[model samples]
Target: MTAVFAAPAGPTASRRDTSPSAVPRAREFRHTTDRDEAIDVITEVYVPHNLVLPTCAVDMTLAWTPLRHLVLGYLSYGAESYLIAPKLETFYHVNLTIRGRTGSQRGAEEVETGNDVGLVFLPSEPATVHWSEDCMQLAMKIDKDGLEAELARLLNRQVTVPLRFDLALELKKPKVSSFVRALQHLRSELDEPDGIVASPLGVAQLEDTVITSLLLGQPSNYYDELHSSAGSALPRTIAPVVDLMESEPDNPRSLGAYASVAGLSVRALQDTFRRTLEVTPMEYLRGVQFDRVRADLLASDPETTTVTQVMHRWGFTHAGRFSTNYRKRFKELPSETLRCH
Candidate 1:
């Protein structure tokens, strides 16, 4: 029942792959020999399920990297298994068995997944799965609520119908392949200790990109509406707020204040921002402040000026976070900017 949320700190798994597609060990890791403990580990990431293992000796390995809107996991039961789970309720999962094979059934739909082939499990259906002795699955859990909310914001209207996706996920298709590649890129880039996603802007942008791509490219019930949505008009909706951010780089405003300027509710303003700029109003303002801070740092004499002073003038109070964002945005540390100047 040992679960390590950070990178693995124990002996290595000889079979673990170093490929970019694999969620790095630096993600959350868990391994167990006890049957109940193994079940608990699985339930920790997913909903409770009835796990009928053929043997009393259970060995399971679980690894996951949880993000703001989704969770990426790798799971393997080193024995034959059958699991019956209730309606997913909250999340939609895409399962790809990278080793051996898996059989899944929901209602009348049945799928055998292996290698590049995958099956999408909708939130509305109960599921049953059979895992082979050597099976290892790259299980991706996407936040259903967040995804639906993204779709609504993009179309700028309420979504009355269930967002059911086509069960078969053809990974070989150019669009699906590109979406998978983007997730892999996010895993690699965000796993670093001081990765670019440390900044609010980077996090918002990546999360938005993931949700938007999935909604647009995946065969969903909302396909036609998404294609016809007035997403182009969103830029105009948020332009006033952006103008305010640019005009008053040093001014820090709450979400409500900014929304008032845009003549929309706080929620609408935030949604419009993600749909248009892939970042929130606050993140955009922070980026503007960083630009101003960099300007001050470059023009001031290093002997008389300080990074802290310039940062405070731009309303950046957190030294470590500010430096990380500044470095990511400018490709160098703020001190480096001042030193070189």
Candidate 2:
């Protein structure tokens, strides 16, 4: 029970020719206008596995006018011998397996991509693909910058780190099914009269929805040190403190209290902060509290909540100090963030 899915003909290409000179070169594959020619060039450069590729169907559509966008592709391959170009380009890719087992090797690590996992690949680096005997994959490609910007907004911080292509997170069955349904629906809309106008919007919404679900579904412990690794020396110690200050801004804990909880002497913590994050612990805490206050003010109903009320709620007791810090952190006055309605 092996299957090999073929790429559709329209404006696409498959790998074709190879020569001795093209073997395992350490250079990126240049972008190509001719899809088929590019595929041929790629197939020639890489070594193919000798196995019977399973049975699968693949349908792909490219939106090249506004931006480079790939609609969706479904692939199921049995035990088949095929060569995947070592270097593959993508703006961004989301892949989920529906059945069987598939594995990808990046650098020195090998990761299994299966029905229980969803993987995101960013445009930072090129990677090679390999699969097991029986595997089914559904993938979507999208604009890298657009996806990054939207993720930053949702997370309320910059999120431009490269995705570890080999990393795998458990995917809930509901999300896998929902993504498939959305892809099918998007494909159907692509063939309609107003398909052009509606398809892009639908795709954008679907991308956002799926991303949101994935983020919310991630284990909290998984992201506990997200900010700690950004050149922060005391990432282990400072990360939790920052999270705590942001989550409980009104707690009114002093620097010493935080240091005690972090199991560091005040001076040791201060040195780590300076060495790692290039800021004092108090300064970082102030920034965190200000962010919370600003967010709270922006989310509050102005008709029901006052600016001072929001400020005091987050431990900004000194109006003058609070205003100064708010302006410094957000470049806007506290009054400006609140909703007039």
Candidate 3:
């Protein structure tokens, strides 16, 4: 079975989506018989992988559509086959077998996907997939930073680690069912020439919808953190201290300095900040500092300035944590912002 879109033909290039939407026009094709060509084509759309020759003849078809940082595609290897792929490294992959069946192996873990089950492959793991002769899968490729940015937005804090999702998505669960429907809806809309997908804002919002659904519905390392509520709003008494921090975000101050200004004991100030803001005083301070860093990155020219110079000027001396917090706060790297400036 084939899933060809009623659109222009191309190898990897398709007509640009008419409305300047995040979704580009669909790229649909049945590729070369040479295994190497098949590999090259898939690699162009996705990442590199080793395609093990099948016992029978090879017939591969891929109908792909890219929406900004995510790609939604239907893939079929016209024969029973196996593919060994290295660690996806910088992104995530999800596969829903709509027809026949598929099996995935990662480390000692092995799982089969079908109508009632789906698979999510995280970035850190190497994987192998076994596709049945008649298998057809709707595979999703999501950029890691973009997905993590959404996660950071939801958590109201930076993502400290790569998201970890259990390999199998239990389709029977209500949340999972809803998420699958979201994917199916987007897939259907892709075929509509003037659907919501044709609207620039509509496509971006839909992309956010799918990303947020996956982050929330499909459980991950941050699942519990997402569900937990934050502390109550800040009290008026602490307004002046917050104002001081905002006025001088680049200024590095100890907890005692903050406490002295607030006229509270160090421990009392710490407890008050946590009870009101759900963060330590220093964490809140870091958030303020990060905002300033973003402002400076946006204001400076990349050719004349460096992320390190800007970061250190704002007292963000710890390189690793600065990068993580930067991405979490703004959803892109400091360097990414610098380049755009």
Candidate 4:
């Protein structure tokens, strides 16, 4: 059974329905004879596979489960075909061959993947995948934004750059192999009639699990940052302080208050902040406060909201120093910003 449930069309879309049966049921195509129809269907739901069909009759089974921000597909076809995708710019495809063999090329690197070796296709990379007639693959598609968001959460930072992944996955390693096994288990649970995935919470948890597993198992650009030992505790400890500063930038803050929020002594907090962010705790706080003040200055009516009002509102007691810092950060005078806006 191929389950391809179209997620609701919005940012907060999921497959969960009060009546579970109302959810889009899985569909399967067994021994599909029409080559053009197969190509069209696969291209629409899956990636565009400019399939090179053999002269012999095409026989294949295609089944997929499309959950929120993720899709699981199973394909077993006796017809040889090549999956030619120049760039998968939206999602990350993790192709695991359950039976038989396949080969893929991304750039100059080409290798054969079978039951042992899984293949990962990132959004930034182009791929040329060729599968043998006897190949049966369990394919997983992860939404790009969801995965990146998860990575950012785990790393305690905003991911401003594209995440490029390693193409070939050697699943012999315990962590990699465990991630594949977990994926298989989740698929089995979803396949059941009364599976937990019928609930919204279940779907969300499963999405998180898949994304977290991939982040931990796969190597990417921020891999070193995640696994780094330097100031490891600082990032976690300072996260709350950063959140507080961002959320309530105008609120009066001091090193002692931030230290309490971070559950560290003032001295320890200062040292950690300097090590992790190369800025003192007060310096970081000042930056956030300045940003808020500048936003107000830019958006406010100069007639109603003066530089003095904005500065005092954001806890800047001095006019000259505030102007100096604001100019340094925005490369423009606060007065200029207010006048222009």
Candidates in order have lDDT scores of 0.74, 0.50, 0.75, 0.71
TM-score of each: 0.61, 0.40, 0.70, 0.64
Write model 1 residue lDDT over 30-139, tens digit each, in one string: 86767888888788787789889876555678878777767877787777888788888768887776667788997679888766667788888988999887777777
Using lDDT as the measure, the top candidate is 3
Query: Candidate 3 residues 18-85, lDDT tens each?
Result: 22122233555544557777888888888899898656466676778888769887776667788889
The backbone clash count of each candidate, in order, is 0, 20, 0, 5
Model 2 residue-pair collision total: 20
lDDT of 3 at 7: 27
lDDT of 2 at 293: 72
- When summed lDDT is taken over every stretch of 10 residues in candidate 2, the lowest stretch is 58-67
TM-score, ranked from best to worst: 3, 4, 1, 2
Weakest ten-residue segment in model 4 by summed lDDT: 9-18
| lDDT (Cα, tens digit) per residue for candidate 4, span 1-341 | 11122221222112112122322235443335577777776776677767676554455556677777788776655557776786777688888876567999987778898777888887767888887866667778887756876775676544546787788877776667667667756766776757887788987887788778777887777777777865244477888998987688777577898999999999999888777766787777786687677668767998887888888988988889889888766557889879974
Q: Decide which is better by lDDT, 2 or 3.
A: 3
Once fitted onto the true fold, the runs of candidate 1 whose alpha carbons sit more than 4 angstroms away are 1-23, 228-341
